[model samples]
Target: MIAAGEVIERPASVVKELVENALDAGATEISVEIRGGGVEQIRVADNGYGIPHDEVELAFQRFATSKLSDASDLDAIPTLGFRGEALPSIASVARLSVVTRHADDDSGTRLEITEGRIVDRQRQGASPGTAMTVRQLFRNVPARRKFLRTTATETSHIQNMVTRYALAYPEVRFALDTGNSSLLTPGSGSLREAIAAIHGLNVAENMLDISVVDERSGQSTVGGVISQPALSRANRGYMSFFVNRRWVQSRMLGYALEQAYHGFLKERRYPLAVVNITIDYDQVDVNVHPSKTEVRFRSGDRVFSAIQQAVRQTLTAHSPVPEIRRAGATHPAYSPASRQPSRYFWPIEPFQPSPAPNAERTGELIPNEQDAASPTSNGDGGFTHKETLPVLRVLGQVQSTYIAAEGPDGMYLIDQHAAHERVLFEQIKADAATSAPQSQSLLEPLTIELNPRQQELAHAHQHLFSSLGLLIEPFGGDVYILRGVPSILVEVDPVRAFIDMLDEMAQGGDVESWSDRAAYSLACHAAIRAGKVLTHGEMTALTRQLEQCQQPHTCPHGRPTIIHLSGSLLEREFGRR
Candidate 1:
């Protein structure tokens, strides 16, 4: 019973061990069903090589496995279940029953275990597969049963485990039915199809096809659908990776993805990807983790560099910035006079001398009339005699999304929206941290009705809205009334923004801190969209503002807001002098 706790902590652990056993048995299709947090009942059915009638009773014995014959097999362990402790451990803590029929035999076998002891065995009529049922889990161990979390939390963990396997084996059909009637059915074949089925077809449609082969390794292959930079999510949970058809987490793989998207995404934002890597079996250790969710490579550094190079080269070749244009169907050329001053001009405006002290200055509100009357500099060296920073020259907009500019050192490509969002995010975060956000009253209050789930989320995060300068009050039922909004986002629709924020929060899975994410979401929405046309001054000012940022190269979402193409890279691409 003590050993059972180590192998199966909760319902999710039981599912993971059972699925691994099925995979080892060569099952092409697997189904899992759980009721009451897998305490009342848990069933795993798999179409695989079944056990013989005689071996049925022995299957639950500790350290007994058909995978390995001798001690030398330990050095070359390939199957998922070699230790053979999972079955024994699980059987020890629950009422366990296994019914199986081998293809070589006509009849099937049924075996039952009660508290780790084989209680019954009989030949029976059953399908040519294996079906195991675990009921009253931890019933023999009262201490373990008492530690289980709520049914909903346990079910969520089980669902997450099922999803990991579904992603790992795209060729296999997988289905998961939770107790609450929430079903996840991933029906058979092709990684792309599986991804589309699970993550939505719209996401798959926008994916950038990526492939790379290494001739030296003698195992070159293609897999992974890179998302367009514009189709990013709020969290990294969407990124899925597999190695040799097994879903495993590799830090090296994540680093490769980051490098590939160095110049494309914003800081703190992660792209949606399904990267599959194929390598020689001997080069990887799949037995690193008990759950088999993590793996280690013999030469991980080399693999990391190769994957990064392949993705970077592919993106650079296929995706390029489009040319910028002005509004009203006009082809505006880049010129010095058309450029505008930067957004940071207000902080560095001219300072005026204060007037002589009067009776009003003593414990009274004295207005700075002289400072108000003084003319302020625009930071472009155009209006006043104050020294200004050097301005970057605007070249054009790339793919109508990134702005290309030339500075004293080198040329840069800037993602206008990401840069602007970062600027606004920093400003808003600082303001909210120091003082209450400035609120702009709306002429008419906007009412928003939410679903039960969204309503719960909004109620839970009411304090987040307060910090962002929004006065949202519950108006009975699942409706909320918005009386004011952040002054910086005055142009935005309050009701729509509030709903979007709620949806984004919900989609993020589990947000530990609501205020931080809310601030980021607000800043992101208030920033410019991808298709907006910027004036010459706006472009110049944007460049200046980006340069002033602490980490100007990347946005807050982890995407590179700018990419510098050196003369060497340009010459190589164009074959020019």
Candidate 2:
């Protein structure tokens, strides 16, 4: 009973399992009808190979799955919801009714199950397919039903799941009805069409195509559509990833995607993408979760690297700048695509909703090898901007924090702290690669107290400490005296910064990641802070130095240093043509 509860937790889970059964049965068209946020009723009808009357009872039995044969089949199971637990589990908590007929059969069989027991069974005349209606979900388990969110939120989740599946399978037609809202997806077998129907025309046109193949495994292919960095969300909820056409949420893949846009996007900003990954069925394990939303890959590192490289290359090839959209523009009231040079963009078409708008690695989580070897250029580091930053005419400072400058195409507002941080981070990285970093001897030694663990950590990584230009002497049990500090970091709190870096490394991280943490900490502390006044030459010099660095777009912590307000946007805001 508990296991069944886990498989059919909410109305969405029930909908997911029933839909998967339909897909597994080779359904070309599927329709989902939900009422009361799917709590009162959920009807899933699929025009697929219907169930045979003789096997109708067995279908509701726990562990009864038609996809798997033996234990070995578990390694490479392709079908979703193979637990066979979905049916009986769902029937146990809801009022369920199913009517199915095979093409070869003369009639269909109707089975009414209330609270898991067969209340009635009879032969009925019906077309070839299966329609399962579940009502009063969680009726027997009031606790589970009570935990469900309001009708609107639960319905949103249901809509998103259906759209995700629609995007995953463009060839399969899907219809979702939630009374007031009807979503119909054209099963015309075009991914672009499906995306437009589900996400809207703006999103479809804004996305870039991605295709990458691993030479190590000729069978592996990663391809799909990725939204421009500009079209980002505050969360990862909008992103969709799939393995063998089954949508799965994976940290490894999500990290790869985020890391690919390290500098292009600010912290907390997540890009929207519909990424499809295809690999040998034997390489991935989909049985990790009962909901089948998580999966395990044999070579997670390889997959990670493949995805990161593909996204990095695509972004590098084209910019994500949006075209100037006016107030009278279509439904979105804005445009997502731009006329960038040589960009692989899908042409936008007028969007129309049908009956059902079906809308919708790698290794050690490391950066590219070339990025580590390259001494200059943030492009090598997988940052979006590659070429040198454009020169700007200084227009003085704002609120004693932001440096306002005029560029050829747009006006630029630079965050003093972030700009300086990026400048220092690149310089630090370059110095670390060349030789020992420069240090300044303090006239008055600074002392800092630490816990026993921190002291031990400080002592353990003394070599790395010296490499970053910190001359420390152990004072006592939990005290350390800093006699010298990195030259650029002297103005900041050197002792506290050094301790924080040690704490970060002690927390647990790989050597490569530890290096990033060290660099980020040093740059963060050393960089000029906001509210600092600067002369015209100082601001101009800062801007020029920023241009010379590799990733001038953002600081080490992924904060944008500059925001360009286009002249056209200003004109539009001012009501000028």
Candidate 3:
């Protein structure tokens, strides 16, 4: 009794095993409808090779299967539901009923089972297909029934499983209805079309195809689509990996993908991907897990390498992130480092900046050295701006840090320090990538005094520092002499930049990805420290440089760079619209 209990864990598990059986029976189109999160009823209808009326009763017997005829078949199992445990297992727990007709049969057969025993069997007229309905799952075992989650959560599991099958078999049409919601997958045999139908056209359009077609590598083939770095999710929920059309969650594969997107995404952010790895049945062992979601591969490391290299190549071929950036990438209207702190606050505009009356051009608010106190706009924190949108105009500085700006669509509050950090991070990465880390010979050598441990660390990583364009050498004792700095930080304090990089390394990050890690550290410390006023030119320059960055949405540390207040939202708040 508990054996069947292990097979059908929930409504989703029932749906999964049933669907795999339908596919194994050569189904072309399948429809899955679940009610009460599949606890109440699960109806799966498939147009496939159905069982004969005489054998319909026998199929409910445990270990009775047509998949494996001999012992040797165990070494090369290809069918999904070969163990024949699904039907009997499912029958043992729920009120199970099946109606199926073979293509050659004159009539269909319906069988009902309770507690793994065949309770009823009858002949009926039906189309050439199979339809199974499972009701009152875990009814006999009230303990299991009590463990089921809410309908909504269980519905997600079923939906997620159906989506996996839909992706695995693009030629098969799949429809899923959870309560009133429905998902229809196109049976046109195009993975992109399937994705578009399920995830939406925008996500599909943004995906880049990874094809290992013709180019053979080992005993498997790999092909799928991965999202551009610009499209990312906070979790790995969007990533899917398939081995021989079986959707399985493998952490080794997931880690490989994450490693492939090493510097492309912010820490903790994951790229969306649907990777399908096709291999022969002989090379993969599918009997490892009760759920059949975990499998053992003959050459696991090779598979990992293949996935990593394939994804890396695709990203390199077409990436939206910019490659090279230099210092002073901002616009010319502002200079933050050189601006002087003003004594008085400038008067700000009203809560909402009304458009200029009858003016042809939207008069810009260029951040200048004037006592520019602007009106308190509560609307600033609500809007999220895209990089392609119109750039905002700098309206001057506040608290010697934030840059006030106005855009055609809304007003923006820009964090000057964060903005500079993003700018420098990009510049450093670009410079480092080309192995041309721009260095500026300091007029007077900056000596950095470090503790004994830090001094030892500095000496150990002296070659690394030289590679990063930090021309540093021990000046004896617990002191290091810095003669040059990366051009991006040349104007900033060299000693501060060096100390910050060391501090970041101390905090724990990949020193091998020293370019990116060091860049993050360098950008953070060397950025315009808050409380430092910006000149009009400085502010303008920063804004312009920011616009040129690939990912201007957030700083290197994942903090937002700009906050916007849409004009319409402002009007709505003010009762104008």
Each model's C-alpha lDDT? 0.68, 0.76, 0.74
Total clashes, candidate 2?
19
Best by TM-score: 2
For lDDT, the strongest prediction is: 2
What lDDT tens digits, residue by residue, belong to model 3 across residues 1-577?
1132267788899999999989998998999999999999999999999998788887887778898897678776787777778888889998999999998899999888887877888999999889999999998999998988998899999999999899889999999998879999989999989999998887787788885643555443778999876678889999999888888989989988988886567788898898988877888887777788888899998788789888978765555322111335331111111121121222332212221221101112243323122332344542122223344567888789788887654467778888888767777676566777656678898888998767766877876676667898888888888898865564567787688787767765444555566778877866777898778867875775565565665676656676656566577667988
Task: Write the residue-wise lDDT of candidate 2 on 390-434 in tens digits.
Answer: 446679999999999865556678888888787777777665676
lDDT of 2: 0.76
As a TM-score, model 3 comes out at: 0.68
lDDT of candidate model 1 versus the reference: 0.68
Give the runs in model 1 whose Cα sits over 4 Å from its true position.
Answer: 1-5, 182-186, 216-218, 317-577
Question: Model 2 residue 186 lDDT?
Answer: 93
Clashes of each: 18, 19, 30
- Candidate 2 global TM-score: 0.75
